[model samples]
Target chain A: MKILSKLRASIAVAAVLILSAVMFVDINDAQAEYGDVVINNYSDGAGMRPVVFPHWFHRVRFRCKVCHADLGFKFQAGGNEINMVKIIDGQFCGACHNGDIAWSVENCNLCHSGKPGTPTQVHESTVQKLAQPSGAKK
Target chain B: MPVSTFRAEFLDTVSGLARGAASPGLALFLWLLCVGAAWAGEWLPLANDGIHDPRSRAVKILQQPREALQGLTPDHAGNQVRWVQVLEKGEIRPREKLFPQTVVQKLDLDVILDAKGGMPAVRFPHRPHTEWLDCVNCHDGLFAKSVGQSKISMFKILQGEQCGVCHGAVAFPLTECARCHSIPRPGQSKPVIPAGIDPRIHQAIGQGQK
Candidate 1:
């Protein structure tokens, strides 16, 4: 009887451990994907959701020089003063987003898809897994 | 002359003035355009002067890469184009400066990151980067003037600091391991190597590890 009770206890402990591990991974996945910059510079202040700038999407189609060199975008998150006025004035994002290059700024939900009150920065996970050089892992 | 002809003549003269002079003339031209737009106080559906036509430019960008990047090595991640290889082979000659007035100075240097216990050391070449970007874009901000001044780890890099400023974002993804961690570790196939390895062997095999 004692052996059966101990076996039940161990199984319960194992199940809880597995559940926690899955929850942790799900939380991390909920945070943000790699190379995604959440721009909350003025979005929250102006009463809108933070803009989730997917660096991968843009970089896949366009070269870095196209934006960094020609458009003069500094290489940092929350660095550029990107606002609707500047965008509409054909300045920063307006360079290409003037209803021709890809999509007009009229589509609001596409870029500003981040959760409310999220901070502006690159969305790298706070968890530094391994905390050592894992540069070899592809 | 007709009103249309007179307007065309005025635009031509202003554009010619803008071309002859520097930034101030360009500013004036933009100011005038803005003033004209404000005066109109309305939008044009098929605008000629106000809006830019991206039809030709978009087509060129889409079509040019196919021929230009032909026969080049493909990358595993990010843009899927080996940009460093592309620049090294002179596949594309991108303008360093937007204005073209300020001459860009190219620099060449070898930044050898030491080999880890398992992984090969990273050999960061400066020539390809300098050919594309200015020195100040990284110096004193991302990396210091000399090596060992900054502590570079995979931890900070994955967090989008240091080299992460470009890599894993715009330049290239972190998946391409062999591209950066290229310098092989010393003595891959050891014939009973010593625990305290000789510096001479390191100098010979690793080349710059010392």
Candidate 2:
């Protein structure tokens, strides 16, 4: 009976240890996936789908100062009060998406698609590509 | 048993042991065992000092505020002295020479919020903030470009959401309530923008137009 009680106590301690380990791993995973920002300020109110701006895609091409400083894009999503009128007038996103610089604003589905799509796969490939040494790639 | 019930029973057992009905050393050992297991997991530190550490070089400048003000050029010194006077004498004098000519081509605009309840209205000066940081630092990130667009509350600021991001950390501690709420104070005067500043800068900042 004494031996059996000792074994049960040991099992209880082991179970607590394993449970805490699993919880910690889950918390770390959540922190790693916090990069995505969803912009839904006026889309739902205006009877249109909200736009999802992927930071990884643009971050790879341009520095933060380019869009934030020169272009005057706000840091928070939906903080700019951007509308279709401002875009056509060549204001916020219009500065780059005006057909000449980047993809034209005519491609609405590119941003407003709202599907998960291939962002995870694209981000992984981009990270791998950028991780390689500069001269070694050529 | 449910986790809460188990926890209550375990705590009662520990307390009973602590009261000398059972082995006190054994109860302490059990408490340490539970706490040590939780501590072993990877977790964020309870306190992250970041740039706000009092021992840091940046914060050391605040110890001798006037000496730090004198370090700048004569023209620039006047601009910062007004802030120092606001801190020490509780005087709200008109801010002169708000910004450097080369950095930005606009005159400074003061944002005056109406007093809510009995609290003084917040007078946010653009020149002083713009001097240290670019427009993008606050715009769209901490504050929306268009006024009344951002849903600002004292609770949000205390949580380090908007103004709290910099106020309590690097710039100045938020304990100085009157520094921001300067509207109702006696002898408060409107800030004077220096002459020769291009009027277009105000238009650019206000409406996002060239």
Q: For candidate 2, lDDT tens digit of each residue in A1-138? A: 987786567657656755665565322111111123445666556554446554423533443445656667654445688888999898888877899867788776555533222121111111222233665321
Q: Which stretches of candidate 2 lie over 4 Å from their true place?
A: A1-15, A24-35, A115-138, B1-210
Residue-wise C-alpha lDDT for candidate 1, range A1-138, written one tens digit per residue = 987786566556555554554454322223233455778899888877777675544543555556675677887778998999999998877887888876789877566656666666654322222232565220
Quality of candidate 2 docking, DockQ: 0.03
Interface RMSD of the candidates, in order: 22.0, 17.6
* RMSD to truth, every model: 23.7, 21.1
DockQ of each: 0.04, 0.03
Question: Which residue pairs come into collision in candidate 2?
Answer: A74-B140, A75-B140, A75-B141, A76-B140
Best by TM-score: 1
DockQ of 1: 0.04
lDDT of 1 by residue, B108-178 (tens): 99899885556677888887787667676777878898988888897788776887667766565554455
Q: How big is the positional error of residue B25 in model 1, measured in Å on the Cα after superposition?
A: 78
lDDT of 2 by residue, B1-210 (tens): 223354456567766665663433445555655555434321221112111222233233222222223332111111222233233232332222222342442327898876554455788887666643566667776788887888777666765468865553233434445567656534534222236744322211112111
